[model samples]
Target: MKKMMITALSVVMAFSLAACGTKSAPDSAAPQTGGATPAPDKKEVTLKVGATAAPHAEILNSIKAKLKEQGVNLEVKEFTDYVQPNVQVFEKQLDANFFQHTPYLEQFNKDKSMNLVTVTGVHIEPFGGYSQKIKKIDELKDGATVAIPSDPSNGGRALALLEKNNLIKLKEGVGVKGTVRDVLENKKNLKFKELEAAMLPRTLGEVDLALINTNYALEAKLVPTKDALFIESNDSPYVNILVSRPDNKDSEAMQKLAKALTSEDVKKFIDEKYKGAVVPAFK
Candidate 1:
């Protein structure tokens, strides 16, 4: 009886020890409620924007690190031409674009029937008159071919620059809408050759002088403030803007992007990097 009782006790002890030796599952390994995973540590917002290559893309690239700290991811798509950015934005492919000024945006909307609007003015890339053949505007020979942008808005801007420099006289009240037909007086008798804005830089040796947009000038390794014979004034109305769809104008992402663009750091970057070729338009 005693041996049977001891055998039963030994059997019970062995079973308990075996059970204790078998490791139980860890608390962390336990199944979560409804089999759902926990949320991520950080929430991220992404904003994709279209911009021109030089200063616009460069500026956006500079702020990427800063935006990341705010849990905002900035994706900048470089565009060579001015048209596609707006098209992409209107089609909802891009969240915003940072290449055009208000005048260009307005004209684009009117012409294309798009609903894009400016979120904020970021920078001003003054149009410049670059020439390899002449050192000064007055040095041009009679009937010297001057290249200007073929786009109506930019063409008018070119005319305005000419009128500002007294090389030509535009019709009264033509202002930003001036065209070749609006030329009232051509004192220099300078012939105007209209080409795509991006091609103006390549035509420097071809034309006596080319009215080059500052962005393209930078891309072609020409500094508007230093290389151009003449440049637009600082107070010029052609300030480059950040544009968004009307519905997204007040979104958090747009606001954050606008803030990042107009931040003092960006202003400093523009001042240091562009060296007056691109000026911060924000106050």
Candidate 2:
């Protein structure tokens, strides 16, 4: 009976110890505190984007601090000409670019056989006709020299603006696709000078008149609302976009940028800073 009692006591102790071990194991393994699990640290990412000097770069600069707070470092590279931005982006030298409109981008993609895509439409820089010598469109003399962008899309845009004001008439239905050859009627016998878009503002005094992009006009200290002889309507179809490759278009960082570019803050900045020269495309 004594041996049986000792054996029973030993068995009871073993079970108690086993139970204790099991209880403590879970206690050490899992936190019993009612706190939520901590989130993993956000990995900071760097995004390199290219843009023109005025509104594009300026607008991009406006959101740099905001993006940094969101764990993205935005590097804005300013390009003087339109071609390099697209070239660099295509070659993977830049993650994206922010200076061209939809027509321009589509034409560029078609012409170069590139597959660049738009991430978001940010704003519109109204195409305008400006001249240092003429205060009014009627003041343009016969045989006056008019400057327009050399690129096909912008050249067509300039021609459309002139045609709207009855400065010239395009071949029927040619619309914004018309070139110098498509001029059905030249009332003033105006000579068309096909210069680069960037050079149009500089040729304001040299050419009898020049059609300039608002961004370039702003860079040359000309306000589109005040200085332009004729400007595109607010509902202009050419909304500038954030262009990127297909591979990175849907990336977390790129989406964040697209969101930032279309945010209310950007709209406010565009309204307050540009007055009417640069209009935000977003609602």
Q: Residue 182 of candidate 1: its Cα lDDT?
A: 98
In the range 1-283, model 1's lDDT, one tens digit per residue, is 9999999999999999887766564554677778777777787899999999989999999999999988889999999898999999999999999988888898889999988998999999999999999898789888889999998899999999989999999999999889899999997788999998888999998999999999999999998988999999898899999998988999987898899999999999999999889989987
lDDT for residue 221 in candidate 2, whole number 0-100:
96
Winning model by lDDT: 2
What's the CA RMSD of model 2 in angstroms? Answer: 7.0
- Enumerate clash totals for all models, in the order shown: 0, 0
In candidate 2, residue 281 scores what lDDT? 92
Models 1 onward score TM values of 0.89, 0.87
Ten consecutive residues with minimal summed lDDT in candidate 2?
A: 26-35
* Prediction 2 TM-score vs. true: 0.87
